[model samples]
Target: MDTKPIAYTMSEKENPAITVHVVKKSVTPNVPSGNDSSNVTPTTPVAPTPSTPTGETIKQPAKPTIPNYAAKKGAAVYATRALYLYKNENFKNSQRLVKYPKAKRVNRPMFVVTDYARSTNGVLHYKVRDVNHGSKTAGKVGYITADSKFVVPVYYQSMPKNKKIIIINKKGVNAYKDANLTKRVKNYKKGTRLTVKKIVKHNLASRYQLSNGDYMTANKKLIVQGDYQIINY
Candidate 1:
């Protein structure tokens, strides 16, 4: 049972604000007794003035936004033998560099790395051979810098053509016919053993060629690359 009127006013200023106010008015008539009619004075009621109506506020246009390319210039995870260049960095008066695409389910790109160096700004730079697009820079060594946040320096190891052993440290690893792990040939459970016939590495990860001719990922997370002995289950 509410009978109060709700009122609101909008400011006409450039940056207008909305305000709301609620008001209630009540008046009661005073009745005098017949014996005190002469002594009682009639009081006059004050009239209320009309309030001016307010107009709606118009919204102002939003300010234009500028992108910060510096913050977007970040480091990419790279391997000693391969790395993907940042799409944001371009050669002198050249086009933006291509990003090294990764294999399916793999986290890193597939560029073959040839050399790496640190710039004066503490950025890590890698020289790699390009593929796919076959741009003018293809087959030639092109330098790409990596942000420090994602750079991991690695030492190059020269191993003989002899067989090498690596241990699987993770669960549910996939073995494929190719280095890209596209056509899965088998799924290896944790504790499975693998004898590496040949170790091939690209920018994103390394692939191990088994004696049986099947290949599996040799990512740092999937296998330990040291002298850890394999135990027969």
Candidate 2:
């Protein structure tokens, strides 16, 4: 399911890498609905009250009101890699600027091109890596969207290629096969999208990271591929 992640900025020194920032935090109110719980003192279970006429003691009744909104306790933290932004890109916070230097779409200088591909209608796709949003100088991670009329201006002159992400653990592979592992969904660092190229059949176990520092094969199948850009920056 497509979910909206909390957006924030990182320091300028954190580009092309995993960056995290604290967003908004809220607290839930604890208005008591039952007997006097809010004002209840641990020393005494029954609340004390003043004496009424004829020396009769009167206990105060609990007051109930609208409770404050709070997210459920123990909420999970959502994090993801930062991505590029473009003008009118249908992203959450899309903006336009015409000053960014135009770089024609090609294999990114950082990530090596691999054999994986995807296509939409007739246009091909490729995976983009080390994407940044806003100014890389700002060191902020954000989201933006772009259309075919891209801001960075990616020309489909040649077929695109790039590396893909994978979870690298033999136990993770075995757990994935048995459905015993939990989910690992993360936000796309906002405004992240990729272009499509032809896909290679299998991952070939080329990239693997060890959980206990032991390497595992990465035979994961290819699903999608594309270069990423902010449209018409």
Q: Highest TM-score, which number?
A: 1
Query: Tens digit of lDDT per residue, candidate 2, span 93-181?
Result: 33422223433222211111111222223222222222323434233222222122332221112223453333222223321111122
Clashing pairs in 1: 75-147, 81-113, 82-113, 82-203
Least accurate stretch of 10 residues (summed lDDT) in model 2?
70-79
lDDT of each: 0.51, 0.29
- lDDT (Cα, tens digit) per residue for candidate 1, span 1-233: 45588888888768677888776766566776767868677899989997766895767986433223211112223432333454333443354455443332223332345555544554545555553243454454466654433333221123324455454544557888887778888887765656677777654356677889988766544454444465431
- The top-ranked prediction according to lDDT is 1
Clashes of each: 4, 28
Query: What's the residue-level lDDT of 211 in candidate 1?
Result: 82
